[model samples]
Target: MTRIPDQPKRLRIVPISKLAAAPKWQLETLRALREPVFFWFTAGQGRITLGGSTRGVHPHNAIYIPPGTMYGFQAMTRTQGVALHMGDPTGLDLPETPLHLRLRDGSQHAEVAQIMDAIQRELEGAKDFAERAARHQIGLLAIWLERQRSSAGDDSPRGLSSTNANERLTARYSTLLERSFGSALNVGDYAQALGVTPTHLTRACRASCGRTALQLVQERRLYEARRLLSETDVPVQDIARNLGFSTPGYFSRAFSAHTGTAPSLYRKARGA
Candidate 1:
């Protein structure tokens, strides 16, 4: 019998180490997710770039990223934590903007850990009402986030402020890239749409994320390519068309160059 491709889960708790085990580009590349993510770090330290600003993240740090925000981080150390992917925020009391909290209170740390563990149990148990249980746990986690943000006051990560002109431009560019990556828009097109020259855009992106505008676009497209190849049974040709590649052959070459493996082989190795 053939296996059905697994759909992306809405509610889940993933270990930080497991997430780090994937190819670095998947997480370290500047990109956005469609769902809100709450990362609770229990050990290790590294720098995380969010909203075009980079900052140091240590143990007990909690980062909340709303959907459509551009963010990435370095798995420089033996990072140990749990990442909670909250499906839909329709009625949840989550913050509208990104938040990076350096949690110093022991009780606060324990509270987050417990909430994550509870969500994990509900998801893994496969018991009756597990979905409902998980949702409730997520609600509680949102409340915890609110209280922590309120008490922390000015929960901004340091380094570069999002208001910096270059950072702001980079943030806008990233947002547009995330929304239109599947289209055939090139870096020049993006720069024109943003009322800036291609060179300026590239410079801003480099300053903000150490990547040129073209590199950012290529990475974002390839990231989605890998996701489709590893997570779904979509044909390589379809994936190419969907991602705006002119032809399957061109897509294969690009994918091979980026991953050092053909799309088919990548999927087969993953047993997708």
Candidate 2:
């Protein structure tokens, strides 16, 4: 069956248990993804670590982890869940930081469940304009989440209108990184663009995601490098130049340091 059809090719929907089977899940440090993921836990309990924060997850709770966020998931019970992996889904707004929410009302839970089912159906049977239709459904889910936060009383300060200052700054920095990663932008340049000092930006990054601003830029660069290597026949030297690297040797060293493999071999291993 199709999973997250009509969504970006990188987007995926899969069972939580299957995700947990990856080798990184057993390690003390979990490898993160280049896209955001929302986990809907139907049954059982688990613990999700996002950045420097860890939270407990129960049935009917939804957890979101943004891209480049270091995270790990653990299930203490027989966890049954659906993971929605996303890539800049347009027309949908969500929290910038990791989120864990419990839909205590039966109707609320039912509505969310229905939306997820509709997403699956669109992927499976909607052959015409399927991507557009699926996006509309996904938008509905985002609106549903926003409504829940609004009705959730004062604790919903994380909404678009009133996200925490640190998180907002970090989110802004993240958005800028997404748009400008191809250029040779430094941390100071990013800070200047955001109208904040490099130190202030670093403080915000530390408070919000437990990573430095430089790391974010590097991560984005590496993500792009890997994508080029695995999805195209682009020569490593050409890829390096495209990504603004001064030399192929530097790119190769950086790639090796981050992935523990040379760029060409990594590409070959993925059957590119």
Candidate 3:
């Protein structure tokens, strides 16, 4: 059966199969961009730096860097690989959270690299064969992601997935936060979905990120509230309800706890 192409405008998903397999990477050479680039080093290992500080990304590592993020890289060893460079036109806005994905040692590294390469080939040539190839490759990629989740043992931190587990978990949790932060007030719920216990999840969250899982959830909700108050004519009561608050007074109190000023005053100060 012929399948619809998975190409998104402004989001180029290139599989390495079509591109020159071995493109040399040089740290001394700088490549600046006016757009964000999401590169997946599926096969080779490399290290990156920003403003002289050593940045870390290796094989099976993928990165979503915003335009002008000021970064560079050096290959740790000689290797050939594929990369996907997604320019920021698709409005697939990356979250304000971390975008770096580092694969764990001894994870299904080769399989992940193969998945990326297959996607690149499909993207490069989307003919009937390529379409099927892309679909198959995407499934493999999902399987690798799943394996990461299942491998996080009892000793593993809550968000730890073996194959870029922490990063994948964070991305999933970030999506959940955006969708139901106001309503889902329990970290355990998020942990359950991520195949982790609440405590481990929180620790993984704090280690991979400087903030607690609860903090991220609350921050996202609060930021939404602030945006609504400042950008629209929504009343405080309605806004509170929209944010899953039972009462305007409660929302106001919570908002005030996080920010020194109450929601109404903060909105007014911003002339909203």
- Sorted on TM-score, best first, the list reads 1, 2, 3
The reply for model 2, stretches above 4 Å from the true place, is: 1-12, 20-39, 43-58, 63-79, 85-100, 125-143, 157-163
Span of 10 residues, lowest total lDDT, candidate 3:
1-10
- Compared with the true structure, all predictions reach lDDT values of 0.82, 0.70, 0.56
Please, what is the TM-score per model? 0.86, 0.70, 0.44
With a 3 Å backbone cut-off (N, CA, C), the pairs that clash in candidate 1 are: none
**Each candidate: RMSD:** 3.5, 6.3, 13.4
Q: What's the best-to-worst order under lDDT?
A: 1, 2, 3
The count of backbone overlaps in candidate 3 is: 8
Deviation in angstroms for 251 in model 1? Answer: 1.6
How many angstroms is residue 200 displaced in model 1 relative to the true structure, after the best TM-score fit?
A: 1.5
Q: Candidate 2: worst 10 consecutive residues by lDDT?
A: 1-10
User: Residue 6's C-alpha lDDT in candidate 2?
Assistant: 21
